[model samples]
Target: GGWPDAVTGSKKNALRRAIQYVETIIQTDISSVDNIRKDPVKVRDLMLSLARNTATVATVKTIRDDMVRGDADNALSAPTIYGYLNALERMFVVEDLPAWSPSLRSKTTIRTSPKRHFVDPSIATAVMRLTPGRLLKDFLFFGFLFESLCIRDLRIYADGNDGQVFHYRDANGLEADAVVVLNDGRWGAVEVKLGTKEIEEAAIHLRKLKERINTEKMMEPSFLLILTAGTYAYRREDGVLVVPLACLKD
Candidate 1:
């Protein structure tokens, strides 16, 4: 069951009620936020896109075209879409994972695009009308939702540690799913993998990201971690800590 189950009181009616609830929240937020007009349709489309695609400038363009597809009058300019996104941020319905850049040995340019996510991953499940069985059957999308959950948890953990969470990607195509950096200059890189089978690949990416950093100007990473869907949490021989989502609690 998704968050809609909370209001619907039964899984049978949950998805319909949940979608209604999401729409209600969007409309309420938009009206309260001033002058955007009631564009829950727009934001709802956005939430759908956020769940299904990476939130990039290109995705935003897709959204613009999508709106215009239905009716040219419905077309929202990039600034308007961005404005609604900003309001969503204020309402805590959506958040973005900013990109991180450390001084590198080589001159590979960094990609500064922020990845968009819903504050509660459950909102995504609700909007998409996905149940546990549905998610299990679609492993690819499961990975994205699982990554969002990891990011949400890491943001909470980072807040307590006086740190912030970011994602990293460079022109050379190197990337890390999450980078936890503290105010005092210590930082760690993390990868979110839904299956233990993917842990090794994630670990390799984290290490590669570390090796790219110019250690003289930037400190070496404090740790490398991979959030996984395993039973027990343990440190691998290669130094990456494999943590099951269940173990990430106070």
Candidate 2:
């Protein structure tokens, strides 16, 4: 099985085994030893909610609603939810893609809400109880999950280069899935698409984003890339490199 098709029950079960270990460690070590007063059920609910929303921008308010909607008892306050999210970050279980506040050509206000992602996509599938068959039938949702997977890999590689991963979205509604910025300030923008048919549109969006960046305030991007799930990888005429996720090394 390939990427999407590999998301089967057995695969999820294997991933769940790791989730069990992390939960046990948190319950026994971090939460207990630190005497954190948060509710365990609320923490579980928050993790599940974040898993269900793998790659999308999520605010504390939205996540709290997700929790309460799933279980009315989970009406946790925003501060409580933030505490839980912070704990997960400390445990290396989750991360937020901070918004990029770059100087731009237009007066587009950057949306500050960070996109939520688990360290690994399989954790999301395990928590959400998603299988390959279900994901195949629901490409719209699976695309988000796939982007989470890509971001996970990007983070790993970016760290090796002393770079950090950030997301871009403005008030005008334009966006980039991930932006890699190195310590020296050189950067690249990326858009992730799970389908080949969306390649051209994604490329156009990257070009437009590049145009908006104020070059006087920042170095020009080292490259613009569109990551996809398609089989072929090549550079478009516009100089944007399209790479299949399967071929990504970092």
Candidate 3:
């Protein structure tokens, strides 16, 4: 069969360029590739690295070398890394969660920084070149990225459900990573953690939110969700929901 005329023109050129980019990184020798698939710790490190360097994304080759050196010195070309991340995202391997705010009072106000996340932890590990052994020391960084990932998944799940994803931060420095509003105007708050322990801190933020916005006028029956890395999901004694990150997906 002959190649279609449309496929022989601009489309073909674009495909060739994309394939070249993929080949450039995939063809490199990086032993960490296998480790990334086998170790969850490695995965967590990679995602945290990316989160720490939110100013830019790196290419596979750069990320590979950086993993070895423990720095971003050999970071990938910005555009190349972005393309690779985008491909991973399309495959549900990674996700770049964007920050959002509601137009409750004025439509002109919007959040400035958007957070990024990966869908599958393994993909993040591969990109960052981390191994399983490194996770223990890097738990805090992983926690933040994990929360970002959970928020991304929850936002996707809440789509078309009359709920909007928002991050709350006041002038005094109180903040909540995520907020979901139901169709009836009821809302839920979420805080992401790496482990199942220490959810009271999350609850404190929820309480602060309630205090900032008068409950009788603007708030509904609120819930504080603490997304953990554990396997189980349950409500805490304080009425907060401690959910596993896996249960948040659509």
Candidate 4:
């Protein structure tokens, strides 16, 4: 069912509508989920944690450390956070991007921490109360949220192909934003770039990651994609695909 109508009616102001919609969601939905005491405050803070660290590798220690650095008094213990995380997982509120591990040409220590993300990126924006104007003022954070959104879409698309989306980063900081590996073991790499200017660097990184993979032990990547916010989608001469985000729906 399309969600039952919210009380945001007749609100011509988009920001007001958005805020009321999220509030309505929390009061109406979070209260109904099973397996947890109904503490909206804890759930709210849990969401705040995901918002602050979205698209980054956030382990329990990572979240606890980040929180402690911000406000020691407000920091949730690791056990508390784990309990909330489990509840959110059951409710599909958070779906982390697991790390991709492949045999490498070098002995680079792969960072196995899962990248933190919400089922929908807008949850971060909503809980953070960030409008598009506010997001525009902090473009770097905007990019992080953009990556979260891209990852969300990639997960949806990968679902049809029996593929799982993973992220990759090694000790040396080499990384890919999304790695779609199918059940049969074929895989593809993707980098989410919000601008055309970054496509060149993203493409270079994708190629570097492919090189790091020990292809002899695994199938060569079926594709290398640079997903961006550009207006057009095309193939680069170097065999990398530069696809606009809009093309995904098409």
**Which is the leading candidate under TM-score?**
2
Q: Which ten residues in a row have the lowest lDDT in candidate 2?
A: 1-10
Which clashing pairs does model 2 show?
none
Q: Once superposed on the true structure, which residue ranges of model 1 sit more than 4 Å away at CA? A: 1-20, 54-59, 66-73
Q: What's each prediction's TM-score?
A: 0.87, 0.88, 0.55, 0.87
In the range 55-124, model 2's lDDT, one tens digit per residue, is 8887788888888986666498888777777777887778778988888877878998889988877667
* Backbone clashes in model 1: 0
Relative to the true structure, how large is the alpha-carbon lDDT of every model?
Answer: 0.80, 0.82, 0.56, 0.82
Candidate 3: tens digits of C-alpha lDDT, residues 1-58: 0123424567445344433433333443122333222223333344445545431234
Model 4 agreement with the true structure over 1-250: per-residue lDDT tens digits: 0012433444235445556655754565655666345456656666777789999987888777765666778777889888778767777778999999999989999989899988877677878888777889998898898888889888989998898999999999899999999999899999999878898999999999999999889999999999887888999999999998779888
Deviating ranges (above 4 Å) for candidate 2: 1-13, 22-30, 70-74
lDDT of 1 at 144: 84
Alpha-carbon runs more than 4 Å astray in model 3: 1-51, 54-111, 118-121, 160-162, 215-217, 246-250
